[model samples]
Target: MNTATGEIHELWEIREEDDPRRSYAFGGRHGQFSFARIMAMLAKDSGITGDDFRVFFYCGIMTYEEGGATAKEAAEFLGLTPQATRRITKKLAEHKMLLVAEIIGRTIKYRASPHIISALSGRQQSEQAAAFHLPTLPGRSGSATKGRTNDTSRPVPRTHRPAGTDERTAAPETEHTDDVRDPGRPGARRRTHRG
Candidate 1:
């Protein structure tokens, strides 16, 4: 069965002889939980800090209501300052572990990395493996740098060169040959001279 939040409400019927060694419930557990274990492994492998792990888990779980939540919202939910939330989100984005799914004037919505989502949903190595292999999110193609486009197939427009400069005339006279000597330096030796 699934909860109203869409998460599977995993159930295990207890039998007299069956002593459950571990519990996967959300609360009331005295020891480490499965989610915590997953986060620990993710943190160690990805070099993310404890705070980052907390923020990441919060975002991953709370994002069910909306496609994603803004940093301010996440901060409020996690009881962290907005600046701290921004810093953590920025780091996660730089590492490609979080993506900006949407942007409104001053608000940006974030989504977990596809790999992280797959892992958390217990589908990391199963029939739904295709979801784990998705490419990094869009808007990361480097097309916005200095107003340039990333489409290399389109030819770039050429600006008119100065009167004295052209493909043939732009090169210096010494550039036509293979000589590596610098003639402008007075103390420089000719290529055929003694060492």
Candidate 2:
């Protein structure tokens, strides 16, 4: 299928598990029946029809990464000018559907919140919520070990060391030996400590 945007080129009927959904392929890129569409269908069944499905669909599509589109890039993708894109992005943010992060110089980068990410997939109820949770940054992955007698000011998480070895195991026992230190001790000192 031509990934280039224009008209709905082809409709596909695909099966997932026991359920089936329609799909559309464009510009060599493929997007099937969106979770947003399913939600819209359900909403129609329940009696809520005032919502903007088209905007939600585009927002979900925007959440997806394609060579990582910036707001300007997204604007171009939607045939919108940069300023118009900014307004739409703000609206999405106000709805808690998108997250606006970082402005380097004049460029703004945004990402969708986990809820929106999951909502795009009918699986939003099952896996998307947890999967979309942002991963911890480096050095903040886990909690510090307690009573270890080492400076834990660093955000880096604790790592495993061989049994019975303290973090300062490299120091010479004779230099500033711990009471447990005996140069001749079972794990004899491996190196001399200058300070």
Candidate 3:
């Protein structure tokens, strides 16, 4: 299974559950744009980490579905502190990936940038979108078509085994024994022997 090419072949055909409910498939153009292109773009961008990409994607989706999203709302959705969310938003804003849509009193609303929206809409990649080159991460050669493999044939170092465990033997039994004390019973104090 090569992850680089993203080509997958299901060897065994699994029968679907006998539920009468209809399953929805979000794919074709939109799915490719959202999951494939946008995610890769976000991952490659030096300014955005994986977490930052998640927050950004959430913000974009929320904005598209529910008009707009605030930093507090984004923080709540991402389970992050408001300050942390603000920092992510600030970075996105600096990179022109996020746009301030409106400001009502103290609350500031944000939406995905025009470039992002255009790209996600299946339009040609804008100059801003093309600027980000996919990073050459470890174990990956930055070639999307190439399948990832263990390039180095170096043997993995062995570590010391824990006490009472042998590599050749099966794991120790977890069954109850006479020496084991039952803590669930009333007055089940362990007797400390005075040596």
Candidate 4:
């Protein structure tokens, strides 16, 4: 239900009831546990340290708006010194976890990337497919074949070289030696056949 104040109801009370802390609760795991955990993990992975995640969680997850608080406002809401909030906001910005935009005044707002949100919400399955290797897309020159062969028979594109230049001149040749090659300097050159 939309409150008379125009705030849309979200699952679980966001803050203390009837205290104007902007808290509302709808009972369910979706609101209370899952969403909160998503926010917490996003904050952590995005490089928000200290108790900044707490402030970020409250402001970002509860408000339902990417533009929740300026650094000064966050400091006030979190009861932190302004300097502390500034430092935290700076770090968040450095890590690309927060976005700073200028409206009427310079406004600092934070939100998890859409990629993170989609993965967290189960709307995107690719993020969870890390355990399995996906076959390369059709018509693409994938590296190997089903028989565990190198598939060197397949033709691959060669780099274009300028006039009077050969493959060796276009790309540096490397020599494999039983003796250790000093990586600090250039090594000797060796030749191999190309088709």
Candidate 2: minimum summed lDDT over ten consecutive residues — where?
Answer: 135-144
Among the numbered candidates, top lDDT falls to 3
Q: State each model's CA lDDT, in order.
A: 0.59, 0.48, 0.60, 0.48
Clash counts per candidate, in order, are: 0, 6, 0, 7
How should the candidates be ordered by TM-score, best one leading?
3, 1, 4, 2
The TM-score values for the models, in the order shown, are 0.43, 0.34, 0.43, 0.35
lDDT of 2 by residue, 91-179 (tens): 44444445555567877666555553432455653465465433211112241123221222644437666688775657653654433
Query: What are the per-residue Cα lDDT tens digits for candidate 3 across 1-195?
Result: 669998887797566688555655664323223345465555554445776777777777766676668889998988999998888776565455667778899887777764555424344445535654322222223432122223335443364567877658777667443344557876464554556
Q: Per-residue CA lDDT of candidate 1, range 99-178, in tens?
A: 67798997888876555553334443344335433322223443222234333355444656778676574554454344
The predicted structure with the larger lDDT, 1 or 3, is: 3
Q: Which pairs of residues clash in candidate 2, taking residues 3 or more apart in a chain or in different chains?
A: 2-27, 3-26, 3-27, 3-28, 4-27, 139-155
Candidate 4: list runs displaced more than 4 Å.
1-48, 62-66, 101-103, 116-195
Better of 1 and 4 by TM-score: 1
Worst 10 residues of 4 by lDDT: 131-140
C-alpha lDDT of candidate 4 relative to the true structure: 0.48
